[model samples]
Target: MSIVIGDIAKECITVDPSTKCQNVYSMFEEKTALEGIVVVSEEKPIGLVMKTHFFQKLSTKYGFDLFMNRHIDLVMGDELLIVDYSIPITEVSSLAMNRKQENLYDLVIVTKQNHMYGAVSIRELIMKLSELQIRIARYSNPLSGLPGNNVIAETLQEVITYKRFSVFYIDIDSFKFFNDTFGFREGDEIIKETAVIISDTIQTTDNEPSFIGHIGGDDFIAVIPHYHYEELCKEIIFRFDRYIMRFYTEEEIERGYVQGINRQGILDNVPLVSISIAVVHNKQYPITSIEQLSREAAKIKKRCKNITKSTFLALTE
Candidate 1:
């Protein structure tokens, strides 16, 4: 099996060319894996900037004063190697290995047409090449490239065994209808966006370590400690609802949405891409069996699914 660029690409961090250097510096500090940042305009990639550029600017005389006033466009590298998403990993690897410092561009910017997709790091590419040779079961969803069901289960087991945490099962409501109406490509984009939103929300607001997993299709699971679970859920729901609602057409938005009826004939008029969440806390209570606990939590999720009244639910018992 050949390696692919998508296999090792890190998620892209984007900034506007007009954005202040201070903001870019702050983002880099927050995201350590950010090897490079893409400068985008109207969702299109225009230039690339690296961590070293910031350091170089900082080392100069009166660097702090300069950085405080400079914009990203003035220092960003305008000539970037743009690659299509389907490029082979071997090709990307060769490109990274053969390039010298004089021709050094460690990050490859990937996109489809004009839209900004993501970025890939040469170091990460090299590491992935090593990992690929080993017998590793990559827990990736072929469609979204997010971790799949097996990973979710393993993460749940680990969280339950070691730490006191709350696990949340997040489902996108009316996803099927959205797929049916807008076509699969758009549906895929929505899924990717939802994943990004969930990831960003967790990373920004929660200080506690979080274990997040993609459980196929429109379902996601997050395991966070009890203290932060409530706040995390609220933030997720708020962001998700705000973003998903934007994906709908103005006509559909105004027409009052209709969802498929359950076993009973009922008219549900919720937005096509709302989120439904179910949370279970791991307490000190005696558990006769793990399977039983899982079943109870699943039952709570089912009950939450039955009512059309709420988008989030937490299992108290």
Candidate 2:
């Protein structure tokens, strides 16, 4: 997808470590616009050679006589940045920013399963990241800055065809009462905190990047591989319970409840804000469409509402 770093990569020549430096120089001469070349062994990238750096080395005193006849690996940059083809531009950009000062402008070697695929210039990486930010700004939720309803719907549709995944419908319990009593400002802080909790927990628990979306106020959604749904749920709850205590006063925390109006229009003592995650997965059942996905998650969410404190309910039977 256009969201990945490889989508913006430029094709570059690959030379084995044993290739002569002069041959690499000739390849650069043939492609005037070429910025770099990847040095590979058995198709796996071992180093990168920037055209400017190569020329600088060759132009040095005795540089031509010394390196022109030697193997390219002798002059190749072993400290280059490399990333998987499917890595997100955001992640790769961070990796690029942290490079040594001298290697800051080097092209990033893009690979698939450790095989050199292409190179991404600094200019191309910047441009693609700018485009991604603009797109997110247009489609993201204003409050949490997570993907909004439209993006969530699209993600759901995309994952509907997957053979195995768990779609989590995350709801904040008693959020309306908390907001009404504490004011919009406090409510906003809670929303942002919740977003961070979900995002961080999922990131730590999963090896691959999980798709998380904000479905507007007090609700979020995440689509991840079917495995470890229960473990993931427990982690989310544990983090939320520990962190949520900070938002309330010591007295209220001690009391374990807040006075607020109920949905039935009567005054009542509403419990402190808690989280509920209703997970619907297709590991055992066939989830044919978005409609089926929503129906199953909705049923689980209803069950989750009846539970107290932070908890998770998964569709198992």
Per-residue lDDT of model 2, residues 110-228, tens digit only: 99888888899899999889987888779999888888888778778867776678888999999988788788999899889889988887754343546888998899998785567
Off by over 4 Å in 1: 1-137, 204-208, 249-256, 259-271, 284-290
Candidate 2 contains a number of clashing pairs equal to 0
Q: Which stretches of candidate 2 lie over 4 Å from their true place?
A: 161-164, 246-256
Q: Going through the candidates in order, what is the number of backbone clashes in each?
A: 0, 0
Q: Please state the error at residue 213 of candidate 1 in Å.
A: 1.1
lDDT of 1 by residue, 1-317 (tens): 23456555556788888899888888888988667788999988888888877667777999877876788898788767777665656566666667667436558877766577788877676677777534224777666655677766665655666446677787877677778667899889878887887777764323344656688889887666554567777888788767766666778666657455533455555555677778777574633444755776788778767754336777673
lDDT of each: 0.70, 0.85
**TM-scores of the candidates in the order shown:** 0.51, 0.88
Compute the lDDT of residue 196 as modeled in candidate 1. Answer: 82
